[model samples]
Target: MRLAPVSLSLVESVLAKPVLDEKGMILVGAGVKLSERMITRLKQLGVSSLYIEDKRTDDIVIVDAVSDETRRSAVNTVYNSMLSMIETERGARRASRPQIGREISRVFQDILADLKANNSGLINLASIFTVDGYLYHHSVNVAILSTALGLAKGYGQKEITEIGVGALLHDIGCTKVPQEILNKPGRYSDLEYELMKKHAEWGYEMLREQDGVSLLSAHIAYQHHERNDGSGYPRGLKGDEIHEYSKIVGMCDVYEALTSKRFHREAFLPHEALEFILGGGTALFDLSLVRLFAKNVAVYPIGMTVKLNTDETAVVVSLNPEYPQRPVVRLLTDEYGRRLDSPYDIDLTKELTMMIVSYNE
Candidate 1:
């Protein structure tokens, strides 16, 4: 059935197996019928065609991109499972459920496959938005990023899965805190901040009790915020004192948090967030891990329109992995921002006079 605003809930309920075709159209689910009103709405919205599950609507479905159901499943599985695990641990009994860990790992693997497939494109940064729901979305993004970094660093699949599981449940301790504290819109009082810091302790206690969970998993919850300079909370371990896995997760967590929007503060753009992290030197995170992340992640991904140093306008077409700060762009318009029938890609770092002035939504 056609959807007006493309509600994810409705999509999951109605479409069992939607697919995207090569042409970028959505395929409808099998054995489902669309109402005429829904069809009208889709047309009004300029969704030219969609691919359906069966051969009947094959022409409509185009690109086999990620489906809303897949996205929702990923979000819910991560969120609800973590909540249950944390709650179980808080009671002082074992909370480690091998099933939960496996589930989280499975979802993470799926997300990583998708991201890697579309690596250089406009990253589906939507996963980082907490606009409506929280916890699950953020966890999924962290898992994907951490896994990506691990993959780029040549870690084996087994180690990546362990790290991915750890990243997903790192914030499970937040479940023990009151909603008022977790969702506080402004700075917390000292008392509240103190309580907040206790999450790490709470998380560690809970994970320690669970069966089949690794030491690294619990350690991540306890150490994600610790800094290399010994300024981090819970423990003041300095320099090489912090575990290597903890250090990697620490950098990933902060990067994800800075890039994510919250009720408290606006999310920084990727470039701005990375700059802040880099500027911190080795004070806030592992310098080597931070540098690796900066190299791999696309700061200004494709499909994002941007302004150039020469006051001209362009759209990113690909990345210069060696120098993430300098990406190749397609000159789509002039300084006046007029459209061009054809665009040419330019390497901004090689072009001495050109820099990215700003990014466009």
Candidate 2:
């Protein structure tokens, strides 16, 4: 299946994957042919892209970082947990641990098992979510990613668990803010920005008192925004002052937020987000953690089309760690604009002169 922008015209092609709502419910099932009415409804609902069956890319299969069941369960667990937190009265902030705590713990365990099993492959991090569906999916992706990076950095099971929990709840403090401020379409004003920035400390205060929640986990919420150079928020601590867990989670947190679509701007693609990280260097994020993230993430995920410096249109078939910017691609059309009779593969690592010029999302 090919991942491409869908419009009202492609009503005849069969859906390669199911279109799901924010709550993990199906909007359109896989193998269902779309109609004009269906396309119009999807567009109205803010669906910009769809996985459509294409004969040219039939053999290409895109793998998720975790299984669909795992992904859905993780999202629901987060949504439910946050919902309960939001519904609580202001004075009762230290109420009993909502059901989401136990539920998300189980979800993290399941994620660890899946990651260990499929550790060999590149992390596929694409998520289907509308702009308003933040926090739930973002939390899940950050958890899985930070855990993977922690493992690659030689962290043990105990350390990884702490990191996973910390990563998942790092943004739990966002619930403390008004939904209007959180979901506003424009950039935050000075006063609104200050209020929004307080989420980290607020989240820390809430989690620190919860049963079964560790000090490190609570601190993750507090310190994930704190930078190595003491340039971060709340209590800015430099170098060793920032915990290793926060370092990992903080790096992943920024990556997920940048790559994720938002109300104000189109998401920076994975490669673009990584480039932003590199530009920051160790001033804003830890250098070691950045290197670990670079090692694990795929810049251009499989099954996405791209254009090369040679002016050929191709689909990413595989990733190469040695050369992330130069992936193995299956050419759709030659430089001369003629479609190939039999599509051929090119390893950009070998074709030293060629590089991906544009991402065709």
lDDT of each: 0.64, 0.81
Score every model by TM-score: 0.74, 0.93
Clashes of each: 23, 0
List runs of model 1 lying over 4 Å from the truth.
Answer: 1-72, 86-98, 111-130, 337-344
Q: What is the lDDT of residue 247 in candidate 2?
A: 85
Q: Per-residue lDDT for 277-355 in model 2, tens only?
A: 8877889888877887887888888887888888888988888987777789999998986888899899999999988
**Residue 324, candidate 1: how far off, in angstroms?**
1.4
State, as a TM-score between 0 and 1, how close model 1 is to the true structure: 0.74
RMSD of 2: 2.0
lDDT (Cα) of model 1:
0.64
Q: Show model 2 residue runs off by greater than 4 Å.
A: 6-10, 36-48, 90-93, 336-338
Cα lDDT over the full model 2: 0.81
Clashing residue pairs in candidate 2, if any?
none
